[model samples]
Target: MNFSEVIKQSNQVCKVSPDGKYLATCVQYRLVVRDFNTLQIVHLYTCLDQVMHMEWSSDSLFILCAMYKRGLVQVWSLEQPDWHCKIDEGSIGLVSSRWSPDGRHILNTTEFHLRVTVWSLCTKSVSYIKYPKACQKGMDFTADGHYMALAERRECKDYISVFVCDDWHLLRHFESETQDLAGLEWSPNGCVLAVWDSCLEYKMLLYSLDGRLLSSYSAYEWSLGIKSVAWTPSSQFLAIGSYDEKVRILNHITWKKLTVFEHPAIISNSKAVLFKEMEKRAVVGSEDLSVHQLTVGNSLFSTQSKYEITQLPAKVSVVKPDPDHANPKIGISAMAFSADNRYLATKDDNMPQSVWVWDMQRLGLLAVLEQTAPIRCFVWDPRRPRLALCTGNSKVYLWSPAGCVSVNVPVEGSFQVQSLFWHCSGGSLILLSKEQLCLCYMDTEEKDQSTSSDCNFTI
Candidate 1:
């Protein structure tokens, strides 16, 4: 893999356009647009305030910049630069804003979850949705973007409202069985809606499009419950991560637990490949030259990383959380299914440095990646089952069926990759540090290249 030069960004990292043609980044109050392939400046626009959030329209013809603190949202058009629009929430105090599915409307949720205001750009009309509850994921849109599901609270009862995106009209409203509805997600096929309760209750209910409860599942009614959940792209399996450091997979047809995956500190499974990241710094002499690539010593601070396969019986580090703490550092806090639904990657907060990969076909452990530092983020390639992650360091780690490899960002040891995301095309990666970002171009010819002899390929 090769890396491009580092570029400056804001606290809000840049985003790749949904259509995969443009890149948008905000530097303070300025928004910069660039060609995704060439990385050249395409357009620049100044916002009214420092952008707290940035989003691209569904059609990729417009950009939305939101300044919640200012209670303002600005929309810029790519087709006509001069045609810009602004919406002010006035005294309602905006907390969150997002683009509607059609990209012709904007939805702004006022502070304290009072209501959701939908502003139509084409018709110049406004719609109001009240009683919006503030939860982990109170709103979700189906894959086709035709319908939206929102969790609502009214008179201490948990309710769900399904609305049609075309006219923002309420389609169905029904009370849910959840005590404290934490989040809701629509299935990829848009036929099922998964509503999960707060961590205090171990409850998950599947509802049909017409607000009918299809099935309900609860593992146990004790301690903490669900922390994260994800659905396979094929909509065949639903994986639920709980506070017990276990993942329960449910089949789409039966809506029953197909299997349970446990994250153990001691990894002794012979079939599971264990990879340990090793980092080293290269020494450099005083003499150096860089005009036309003459003899020059490498920077002493430049770090290189590689993955080494460890034998079985490896012990991963575990930090026990204090019981008196309000939010204990335990359970499977992060879980993601690969795009192809062949692999699932998960992280247990208590085991801060280890990542577990599970094989969906066999429903068993596949690999374990133990990084030296805590993992900040991990994402899957959009077009493949490849996985990439970062540890708040200057390197990006990748794992494919072939093997695992670690590549450093070529910024002379200045850029640390705190988080990263793969482009929509899965051709490159956007690595973000505290206030800077860069691009990593994966060599297409060796996109599935094998790692060193020390590494072990799982598939």
Candidate 2:
């Protein structure tokens, strides 16, 4: 299938609307809403200033934009323009921003500095936090909004600092003298925090969100830098992706390494791995196109069952004697597990540009999707199990277990596909091919068609 005529340009930071009917993208001064089924730009917005990022309100009637520049944060009521508000500004060095789970507050840094500020959307008030070092990234509000985790960088060392946001109280800090920090994340329940290092040694620390030191573990010693990290929705385990072509699932509380999944170098490019949900299981995608799943714990460290690394095809260049699996061979370039945790999909570096989907519960093969040239990047629908694969030929294929649909989208005159994102609400699908961002939806006939949508695609 070819997607050349089906794509549309979305100049905004696009998001799926809450109900799965519309796609929203933020352009220079506006947040544009499009019909998901039509892949058509339906509504246009004019949001002033450069919009850094935009997130939807729980109800879908409002959109929040974290724009760069001094002064008030912007809140837009889609139905009522007058209800929008611009929040007060704070210190410099604020490089990132995030919303609290309750959608009541916004957490952002002061430029590139170490201090974090919490802004109360309701009160329009701001609170500042101080960290020991300048931060690289990883300041996130837990799903409950009670806690925030910070990964700060100081020279070569990185510190994982946890804080109670309600009172701006310091909870604990995970530090290492030998390794520099790379990233940090909190489990869904806000019970456990995983901290990874940038050093060659496989170094990661798990901390209890309540300020307790839970445990720590390292991957095989290739010094392949840890690239990405994620926690299962159930909170029982953590998934760490590394440059070593392996993704390891660890018991959150016990620090026991449970599973190691190997991907081929071509698919993974030996970059990173991430976990997505499908039905009741967890789907993990690697820099290689290899994806797999296992049971998830409702609580941290719920799985202690031993597992050997399941080696993928020979195309996946992984070291032999991988402690976890024997013969793993799915080289993954980009991947995402469906939100329901049922389907695990991967984009491979191979020809025929394909996206593969596997049954999470069965942990076996399900379908192989092909449309254009080698799949460069793709994302799964966060609200549904659909897969959107972008290819090197500058094409996009919307794939499901049933079949594949193509959308050849280009933003302005851009060529190769760089990234693709599925809106969490299922209202829109975003394409980042080359430098420009394009938003798309199904044709007009599909606009009102409702399916079990629960996937998110992102570059």
Candidate 3:
């Protein structure tokens, strides 16, 4: 409900620490660390080159800045400003770099997916992992930060390797049933590892912590199978988005399809409430003293938006993707579960401007959000059963079981929200624009987290 001054960011690399204390953002070759609550600069450090990627260590004590083109990674400690470490891959080349779950170990993958190098800050030792596969999401660490599952490609066969993060030892290595492993993720409980195949195969397999295959599932014998996957906070249900423009919920016990939700252009359901965003230009008033609020062509006060509950049987527009395209845009590309695991929100690529929310208890659609622009990103509040989403516009939209509301980013100049991130406390949000970023402090004092039979998601 409130906003902070816009801060300039060079790259799209901005992250909040897991401890919800510091905010890190990259500007050209400088890394700026600020206090999350006060937005005051606490520390500033220079990097070797332009920062291509940036992340915070799990403990939130250190920050890592990576320059892929230069094959360099720089780590800075907040407690000891002068104590900084730099890891240079030299000519070997560095394609990806990240921190291990331990917050002390750094993992750098070489170019061409040749190998992974693990650097330890505590032990000052180096460990090398071979056969690292080049995929979208090939590496994942469990929630407890104890184990890591890595997808590997060995002799034309797909494999998975589980390693203990304490010493980076190979605990288990086994061949995967996937023809081409696309992505893999560990459940929130860290009990099961879910691996899905490429767009060509509609196969999904679940494996145990010890590399034993637990379950296999396939929705249909079609292409562009699984686009996205999400596990409930409780890890009781696994939601998989597929190319068929549907989301299939699988129970943790059976891992079988418990229910399927489809996105139809025509919505005639009475149980679902549809909130459509409407934008209109504000009529400039001749309030002589307030002329300072005006800009050259358009300013923050130029236009405003609001959400109106539209009548049922509404027809939403859909953009059909070309079949010959490399990555067709016609599937359920995004999904998120509420922190309480009571609601599920999804976005279908074909209906770019729509977001659907489903109820897990009644197992039905609750509300539908139809925006004027494509839904860029949506995330659930960590503390409650609320959802916040952003379009490539100057406003942020939110939905809850109680109702829906759209708030404009009160700022001068054009600050279109490209994406958004929520603070761990869910009391504030970091809204990123083209080259600017701002923090949105939510007004939770007046609002209560009470839900009625009718919620904020539409079918």
Evaluate all candidate structures by whole-model CA lDDT and list the values in order: 0.88, 0.55, 0.88
Question: Which lDDT value does model 2 have at 199?
Answer: 42
Which has the higher lDDT value, candidate number 2 or candidate number 3?
Answer: 3
Tell me how far the alpha carbon of residue 311 in candidate 1 is from the true structure, in angstroms, after superposition.
Answer: 0.9
Candidate 2 C-alpha lDDT tens digits along 1-459: 113232433443656765667766665666667676665776566666667788876667777777667533577776775566766555463455666656667766666465767777677777776663442336666787777777765555666667776666778775543366655677788777776666456687777765566676765676455655656566765666665545566765467987655543333322221111111223433232211122346421111111111222213322233447633323233445677767665443322234445565654455544342345567777666666766554455565554444433432243555677765555455666433555555432233332222222222
Worst 10 residues of 1 by lDDT: 287-296
Task: Sort by lDDT, best first.
Answer: 1, 3, 2
TM-score of each: 0.95, 0.65, 0.94
Clashes of each: 0, 85, 4
Per-residue CA lDDT of candidate 3, range 84-115, in tens?
A: 99999999999999999879999999999999
Candidate 2 positional error at 293, Å: 39
Residue-wise lDDT of candidate 1 within 79-184, one digit each (tens)?
8988999999999899999998899999999999999999999999999999999999999999999999999999999999999999888999999998999999
Model 3 misplaced stretches (Cα beyond 4 Å): 286-301, 446-459
Error of model 2, residue 304, in angstroms: 48
**RMSD after CA superposition, every candidate:** 3.3, 13.4, 3.3
